[model samples]
Target: MQGLTPTESISFILVFLEGILSFFSPCVIPLIPIYISYLAGNAKQVAEDGTITFHRKKVFFHTLFFVLGISFAFFILGMSFTALGTFFQSNQLLFTRIGGILILILGLYQVGLLDIKFLQRERKFQIPLGDREANPLLAFAMGFTFSFAWTPCVGPALSSVLILASGTGSSLTGNLLVLVYSLGFVIPFLLLGLFTTQVLNFLNVHKKFLKYTVKAGGILLILIGIMTFTGWMNGVTKYLSKFTPPALTREEENLPPEESDTASESDSAENSEAKEEPVKTPAFDFTLTDQFGNEHTLSDYKGKVVFLNFWATWCPPCQMEMPDIEEIYQEFDKNEGDIVILGISNPSSAEYPDNADKSKEEVLAYLEDNKYTFPIVFDETGEVLQDYFISAFPTSFFIDKEGNFFGYATGLMTKSQIYQALEQALAATEQPSE
Candidate 1:
């Protein structure tokens, strides 16, 4: 989530808040007593005044087990969405459209525009609540299994969160966001379980507010569906970017190295001092082997431009833009080593689920299959990628002949983008002293 923008952070916040609101939804608020009774213990003691006998410790223990079950269910769902998002990185437009469509359908169902009976049907796990023994494991299973029950209020929120997760294009980030959203839901459920007497009374008094809250959730779902469909989330973030911390953008990538907000920062003093004005970013030096086990080093290519790229074979965008990268490399004067293009491959299955644990032979095979002519190196330890603070795939770093970082782009680059960065690096290398 290195590239997380203000808009995305805000989205996570909203999702979490929605989770909390789910507790107050009509379908859920009315079920509080059932949840409390089931989670606290099946066997209950009642007082003469009809006040349930409170066993706080037992309730907490059983509720914790229930929460764990809920976590397991949500975590898996979140991860699945994240993986799907990452898999569709190449076709983000298509992915976004499909995700948007799904959200729209769910939203329509919420707003009463589309009455899907299957979606409306109550599908809760049957735990045989009354007279049953206080079984923690059973409660846990109920919590996990019942997440798919699809109540009106929770359904919209769950679908909304899934769309948001899929939009991020990173599994770890998607998983974490979903977990935060789940926390919002779980906290309230836990509170209800813990303090049955107080909350039950509160729910009774505010009974009329429950339906309205569900409506509010539906409205929110509709709004999110629109944003997801139009890809306005990023647009909103871009608009607010000035007040927020620096973020990567395609517009920024097209600019010269001097114009990049992130690329200009020095990794070390040796790279160059970080300056408000033009300053050399410490040069990245590494000893890496190409697919042919040929040794290459930054120092070896001294007095030449290194168009360093961090990429993975599994990445769609990476694959999409590589042909352009190869074209640029082919035009370079390799005989004099005036310009070098080295693509550093991060061979991790987590980074590319479909292409994990790539060996030298596999890497070579992939390059050959693609007919790529540019030089390629495998970043086995992955330190090279982290050293560069790579926030996205298909990132490129332009190193000047002086071995200083010139400029970089965090995503796919056009042939013109590659040319512009090269021209800037060449210019920076020959920059005159004061």
Candidate 2:
């Protein structure tokens, strides 16, 4: 439910750039002429004084429909990937690890270090252009069918993107990512349709550059794979977030006295007229003891803004953000104030061996050694983690004072972001009944 953060924005930009690079793939750029010829088969062309001119009006609209068809196919692909992601959302950590490994192998294939035969083989539907004129309908059908025409050439890049899309937090995010990539791949096609002669001349001249596109994309995928596998992307995201200006401030807390009085009067009237209903508590509630042996239930903290952070002892990003959590905990009077900060960890045990590297004893010892005073709790059975759909380490959830799910953020967060999220949670109002 959160707005696009700096990390998401950066990811979208990279996906868009990847799409643009896909257009210049070996199978794509070289075959542009053939595709254009099919699209503008009957359009007039004039050759005058060593220069070429295409019938722009005739070809442009056809190209538009062709790209639209490609876009439609891409959208469908995005939806399918997103749906798959949603189904596997609970096993997010497993999905990320598997996806990272797959991406790494694909990167190797792209760099020529590995030989993946299926990837090297191209399989696409072929449409014969014997005598049919290039009308908008035909162009659209061609664009849709031919989208799979260069699968082998674009597969590596496209697969990497689909893997990313499948791991996103929301279906909408995954779909938007694919849309951005489609824009990158199709914008060039649209331009070529408009200025076919000029683009063909440029491509013919600088054809040497096309060979490097795969290599560049391969290196990028490799880096992303390593970061994702090691859980370092969250740290990078946290670092980048430092450059984003704070979205909200505490100035609103210092309203004028007259305005406060008026608000208080309005609240009094509303409270008198409004009937009180039992506050709905969410289902992820649990009774767990902290390191100090004091048990806590999520429902018990209904009147307070709860900052529940799901982390692991082995996660570097989790360790990196501990100090900030400690600082914030102290600022909030160590949970004595209206805000309560709790760290949830699922250490490795016979029951949940995949959850963490350390045992519960080791986790407690680590907390003691680090002198982290914030309340640290254990999800011994790991049910809490499943209920929360925790795919990545250092994921934080914010609950409003009314115990409603305000929103959540994945990856590490800075102190400022943590504060902003808490503020937003505190300011959030309850959803009305249907």
Candidate 3:
């Protein structure tokens, strides 16, 4: 609930400038004229002579609704970030570390150090020109939907802003931050729509140099990510702390017990009523086809320690964990046959609904492009996915040398965590069985 500090006021100006730079990014700038034309319903306005013949009123109103639509979308995103931060307030430091690493990767991708092709894939939401022109409502809806298609530059900048907004400890503050960002973003578009011909001329004249805009944005994004990772904001935060007023002192007293806590203890006793029962399970086995057409059966790898990972190329956590998985798997030679790693990617097991419909060819290409040396499988029918009951991507299960179900983890795991799991699985191989 604190107001903006001097440093924050300065940061907001930078955020706004970054928004302008995002407007000039390669993905968005070239398409600006088309968007203007679509909204104005005046394709001939920016013709060879740069006539600027569009109806001013129509352009202004259309662009206004468009701006409102995207701004609303951004506000909702801000609320979501605030809610997420609230839920993880107890673990904010850990949450920040994870966010920092992700932002760093995105920065690297933006700078061309990493070529994550999927990140560059824009959502192809092409509304028919006639449809938009015929109905202004459709034009407004187009603007609303287009907000979801955030380009690479805007994505990282917005992410950084959301991090700051979330730390404000108030949902209203978070929403305002996004509104400010959208305001900073929407102003340029409004201007460009008003003066389409001149803007196009300016853009065309400076087309060659505009390429550096994205690079510069990428560099700035990288710095923000580094600052976040190293907690460089602390010094600035310390300065801002001086402005905060002291709270009136209150008398201390013993607090009453929470009902939910008492109820939960009673509930725990009731829940344990079924705990006396034990169920026997049979050994799990399944086969899947590798990318090269060879079949790998779990039964075939019996008596060897196995690291079974379920992952998808589109999953960021899956991608982040791959390097460590590769390193650990490489430690044991395949020729030795004592330790093995099997990566299973099922089309039907895609964790993200947006990435669910990926083609077999795409999956294969991604695997090959990444140059992963471990055995990979494409579960075309998802039969393996069914047998394992997997609903989350980047899930890992370790099987002991005796092929018993040793341990399993849901969601992402760090390199050290995976190694610890490995050590536990290795230890499982030595202990006497009951």
Candidate 4:
């Protein structure tokens, strides 16, 4: 099997961060202090001055053992999920649907719409020995028990890992992958334990900030839930294929053409034809309807320079880039006949049930809430996305006025970058440069 791509590695790192954030959730956030306190209490007695002194070496080793224990538990969980996924690979869609439903239920729980008794269960593991006699193995067991008991708090993060594992199509590999994910969470906690007093003091002073942070974390979980349950992640992946390096696209394009040839002579002829045919760079065309029911086709503005964007209300990066897109849009909207800017709302499936036929009303509400006033379209059925082949949020296509595609961006674009691209597109239009 091919090694994971750079993009996949980056995505995994983001997954790791998501795991860390989930570990710092409301239920788990406040308890970090308590855990530290418990560990601190286990410290050895100080001199007669009444100061408590901890054996730093012992503390460090204990924390490390605890992290190892937590990591082991997650490794086992990942292995189990991977095995189950392998067994059910024949029913991939059924598994995906089931996972989606479970994610949705979890989201509902986060939003206070639903609750599960088992999910609320929080059992702590205890070591039946003195701290002085505590073996690393016992500490590790406690760590495993801690992780198992806190399943609800870590469910969102674990779910993400499980989703990735299931998609990997290999049980052992997938399980190991999630074990790495568990380390991403455990490492931070172990470090915090090393500076227990400092961290506890900081948390105590900034308790209000911590509350909001946990709230934000909860909201993020909810977002992840929506993305998972609605199949938005799959859609994003599909869209991202559009921006895959040209080499991969060319190779893929030639695959089907090659498969169709039977005879050697036919294959030679097809190869000749392939050599002659220019590699076509991907482009996007979509129809957007305004609140007034006016329809606009991106292709209709072909003779004019255009900026095409894919975005959604719930996406933070999308939202962050909007004001910049809007600033550029305003500059060009005034010169609409020369440059056209079209922003398309790419809602996750959970947010848009009808898919491509997503209502114009919802778009309006989104616009109003986000304070965006650009020419916006809805890619409910993802037909427009199919043409563009985008994978990430805020993909922008810069088309020259002569209908020649100049270039595109796959992630968030800064205001200056948008302006620079627009300026380049405009200059290309005026000079007819390659």
Best by lDDT: 2
Taking the tens digit of each residue's C-alpha lDDT, what string does model 2 give over 20-71? Answer: 9779764355346446656655564546764545578887988999998888
lDDT of 3 by residue, 310-339 (tens): 887767778898888878777877415577
Worst 10 residues of 1 by lDDT: 1-10
Return the clash pairs for model 2, or none.
none
User: Which of the predicted structures, 2 or 4, would earn the higher TM-score when compared with the native?
Assistant: 2
* Top-TM-score candidate index: 2
Q: For all candidates, what are the clash counts?
A: 4, 0, 0, 8
Q: What is the C-alpha lDDT profile of model 4 across 180-277, one tens digit per residue? A: 67867887778866775455456556767766654454565555445544555554444433343321111112334234223323543454455443
Candidate 4 versus the native: TM-score?
0.37
Instruction: In model 1, state the lDDT of residue 53.
Output: 50
User: Which residue pairs come into collision in candidate 3?
Assistant: none
Write the candidate numbers in order of decreasing TM-score. Answer: 2, 1, 4, 3
CA displacement after TM-score superposition, residue 83 of candidate 1 (Å): 37
lDDT of 1 by residue, 36-55 (tens): 65665543456799665546
Candidate 2 runs further than 4 Å off: 1-85, 88-200, 208-304, 310-324, 327-340, 344-366, 373-395, 401-403, 407-434
C-alpha lDDT score of every prediction, in listed order: 0.58, 0.63, 0.55, 0.54
TM-score of each: 0.40, 0.43, 0.35, 0.37
